[model samples]
Each structure stands twice: as structure tokens, then as C-alpha cells.
Target: MNRNIFIANRLREVLLNGHWIANTNYKEQLSDISWQQAIQQINELNTIAALTYHINYYLRGLLTAFETGKLEISDKYSFDLPEITCKDDWDKLIQDFVKNAACFIEKIEQLDVEVFEKPFFDEKYGSYLRNIEGVIEHSYYHLGQIVLIKELIAQ
Candidate 1:
């Protein structure tokens, strides 16, 4: 299998369609929750909505870099999610997240295998493969948090 295709599939597993890794993707986990439930706080952990926004933040930023050849994202602002007060707001965020995740996967699928070994945007950040895998691992980390938070909120 093409490396790009494999990587894209792995991303899809977490973000959109596949369920082998966690038995639930972001879309599945998020699809049924209400805005109120999304924002429910539990013992100082991030709300589901906030974690969703955080992952989407990286996806959108990386998509921009893939399209425009500029890497402008900062870790400091990755979690700076705006307020989601109503269902419209939460729905819009989810919609944006879905769109960005799809776009991000497409960008990965389009990359040349050689590009994966090249420095992402700067040598300081390491290779494109490093960053892409980082996103996957980082997403899973937060996805676990989201699942646990949902369980806590239910209890």
C-alpha cells in the first residue's frame, strides 16, 4: 500500500470513518452529544467541545500550511477555543472540525512519500512525517480524555 494512503487511512480511523483503533472516531463520539453535554465541565478537565476545538485547531492550521506553504500555528493558541454557548455554535464547530479533518486527510494523501521525510516547515520542527504522526498521537491522547470525560459526565 502507498504510504500516503496508509497514513490517510490511519487519520480517517481516528477522525472520520474507521473504528479499529478506539472503536469510535471523533465523528462518532461527537455526533450524538448535545451542546450542553459537550460543554459539561468535569473536575477541571477540558470540556468535550474544547478538546474537539483543540484538535480541529491543529487540523485547520496544518491544512492552511499544506495549501499555502506557510506554517503559522502555535502550540500556545491550540486550545484557545472560542465560546460555544448554543447548539448552533457547537454544531458549527463540529461542522468545521469535520471539514478540516477531511481536508487534512486529503492533503496527506496528496503528499509525495519523499515529502514525508523532509523538514515540515522548518528544520527545527523535524520531518513532515514527524508532524503528521504527532497530530495522530496527539489526537488520540485527547480522544481518550474526551471518552473518559463523557463517561464521567454520564456518571
Candidate 2:
């Protein structure tokens, strides 16, 4: 196999694994326990919903900026975001979030790896590669929190 293709495959693999890990840590339920139950007994210091939603928000922002050359604001998709009512809404949001995240990885793959060294945008942490990896690391950190919170909710 060509070396470039090999690297491309590995890069795709990394994105897939990252997505898998993120999802594994938080199963989207169509019949989740009530929100009150989800955070019951949990301190306000811990963000019961913010952690997951923020990762999705950031990934969407980064990918949209890179692909469209337009920087994104946090609430850009507020209108489309799912409501915090039922489990179905939660599931839909997760699906949309994952779809957008995959699109981000695909766009990154379309760029020359050299582009990774370029600024992701005009933001403070503008380096493309760092932003990409930062999202992954950030997702992983929040994913861990989500898993722990879910376990607490279950208990």
C-alpha cells in the first residue's frame, strides 16, 4: 500500500476511535431517567449536561469554521439544538452531534496534513492540529465525566 494512503487510513481510524470512545461513555437513551434524577445528589460544581453539550458545540464550531472559512460562535446552532425535555430529544442531539463530528474529521482529511500546522482559525489557539487534538482531548475528558455521572445516576 502507498505510504500516504496508509497514513490516511490511520488518520481516519483515529477519528473513528475518538468518536467511538466518546459515544461509549454516554449512551443516548430514548427512555432515560428523568433529568432531575440525572443530576440528583450531584453537586452544581459538576456540569451534568454541560460537559457533553459543550464538546459537541466545540466540535461543530471547529469543523464548520475550517470547512466554511467562517468562525463560529457558541450559540450559532442554538435554534437547532434539541430541547431538554424527553429522552428522544437527547438521542436526536447525540445523533446530530456525531454526524457533525464525523464531517469535521472528513474535512480535515481533505486538507493537506501541512494544513494542520496552519491556524485553525483566528482564535487564540489557532493552530489547526492543536485544535483538532484539543477537541479530542477535551471530548475524552468530558466523556469520562459523563460516564461517571451516568453511573452515579444509575446508582
Candidate 3:
């Protein structure tokens, strides 16, 4: 397959439906938890809700850049998750997360295959391929955390 489709598939593998790598994707994990479960704090680690917001933050930022050619997201603000005080709040965050992940994947699949080799917003960030892979890797990193946190919360 072409690189764009291949990259989009990898993005979906981690964020959406594919289960080859983690045996669980974000949608599956986040969907199974309750709002109270998501916001529960466990020691020094981040809450599941916080991690979810953090990952969605980057996905939304990257989607913006894909649509407008402007990368305005700052790492400093990525973790600024508003209070998810109720089921409605958590549900809204999950809804937005799923929508943004779909949009991010659609943006990737629409890219010209050649754009993968181009710098992503800036040369300092390396190629588009690099950043896309970073998202997959980063998502897995937090997915693992979320899984373990869920397990602990159950204990």
C-alpha cells in the first residue's frame, strides 16, 4: 500500500480499532471505564482522564496543523485538562477524543505520499513521518499507563 494509507493504518491501530500492538486501543479502553474511574488519582501517576486529555490535545493540535499549516499547540498547555466533574463532562471529552482521532486519521490518509518526507510544520520537528510515528508511540506509552492504572484501580 502507499505510505499515507500505511501510516493512517498505524495511527488507527493505536488510537482506534487495530489491536495488534497493544491488544487494546484507546477507544476500547476509554470506553470501558466510568467517569469516576477515569478521574481517579493513583499515587504520582496521572489520572486516566488527564492522560486522555493529554493525548487528545496533541491529536487536535496536529489536526489543526494539517488543515491550516499552522502548529500552534504548546507542550505546556497539553495537560491542562478541565475538571471532568460528572459523567456528562467525561462523556464529552471522550466524544471529542474520538472525533479528533478520526479527523487526525483522515488528515493523514489525505496527505500526499511525498509529504511524509517533508518537515512537519518545521524542520526542527523532523519529517512528517517522524511526528506521526511519535504520536503512535506516545499513545502506546500512555495506553500502557492507562491499562496498568485501570488494573490498579480494580485492586
Candidate 4:
């Protein structure tokens, strides 16, 4: 298998399915959570809904970069999560997350291995390889937080 394709597949697995690390991916962890649970605050830490939005927001930014060849996201606005007042709102957010994740995987698969070696948008930002790996790492980092928060909420 192509290395790029392999990486893309791994990204999909980590984001949407069981991965080697925790045997639980973002989708699995978020699957059984209710809207109330998602918005529950534990010790003033971020709610599951907010974390989910933050994760997908970065992914959406990366997807935009891949599609438009421009990195237009800023950290200032990254955590601006929407108000989840109802089940439908939370459900729509999850749906959007899944769709954006699929789009990200598709974009990664379509890129050539050579592109991975090239700078991602700018020289300071590093190569596509680095950014892509960073995305995986970032997701896993938040996945851990989400899992912990869910556990805490359950108690």
C-alpha cells in the first residue's frame, strides 16, 4: 500500500473506529453520550460538546487548507463552540464532524507522497507530513480528555 494511503487510513481509523492505542476512537467515545451529558460541566473543565467542536474545527481548517491551498484558521476562534440547546443541535454537530472527517481522509488519500514532503501552506508551519501527523496526535490528545471527562461525568 502507498505510504500516504496508509497514513490516511490510519487517520480514519483513529478518528472514526477502533485504533491500536485505546481500542476506542472519537466516534466510539462520543457515540453513547447524550446531549445533557455532552454539555455537562465537570469541575469547570470543557464539556464534551465543546471539545468535540474544537477537534472538528481544526480538522475543518485543515480540510479547507487542502481544498483551497490556504491556511485561514486562527486559534483565537478555534474554541468558539456553538450552544447545544437540544438533541438536534448536538446531533447535527456530530453529523458535521463525521462528514468533515471523511472529507479530510479523502483529501489526504488524494495527495501524492511528494506533497507530504512539501511545506504545508508556509515554511514556518512545516511539511504536510508534519501537519498531518500533528492532526493525529492532536486528536488523540483530545480524545484522552474526552474519555476522562466522560468517565468523570459518569461518576
Spell out the clash pairs found in candidate 2.
none
Over 4 Å off in model 4, which ranges? none
lDDT of each: 0.92, 0.57, 0.94, 0.89
lDDT of 4: 0.89
Displacement of residue 128 (Cα, Å) in model 2 is 0.7
lDDT of 3: 0.94
- The most accurate candidate by TM-score is 3
Candidate 1 C-alpha lDDT tens digits along 1-155: 88899999999999998789898889999998999999998878999999999999999999888888889988899889899889999999999999999999998999998898999999999999888999999988998988899899889
Q: Could you tell me which 10 consecutive residues in candidate 1 have the lowest summed lDDT? A: 61-70
**All-Cα superposition RMSD per candidate:** 0.7, 4.9, 0.7, 0.9
Q: How far is 31's C-alpha from truth in model 2 (Å)?
A: 10
Please provide, for model 3 over 47-129, each residue's C-alpha lDDT reduced to its tens digit, 9 standing for 90 to 100. 99999999999999988887798999999999999999999999999999999999999989999999999998999999999
Q: Which of 3 and 4 is ahead in lDDT?
A: 3
Provide the TM-score for each candidate, comma-separated. Answer: 0.98, 0.68, 0.98, 0.96
Query: Which residue pairs come into collision in candidate 4?
Result: none
Prediction 2 TM-score vs. true: 0.68
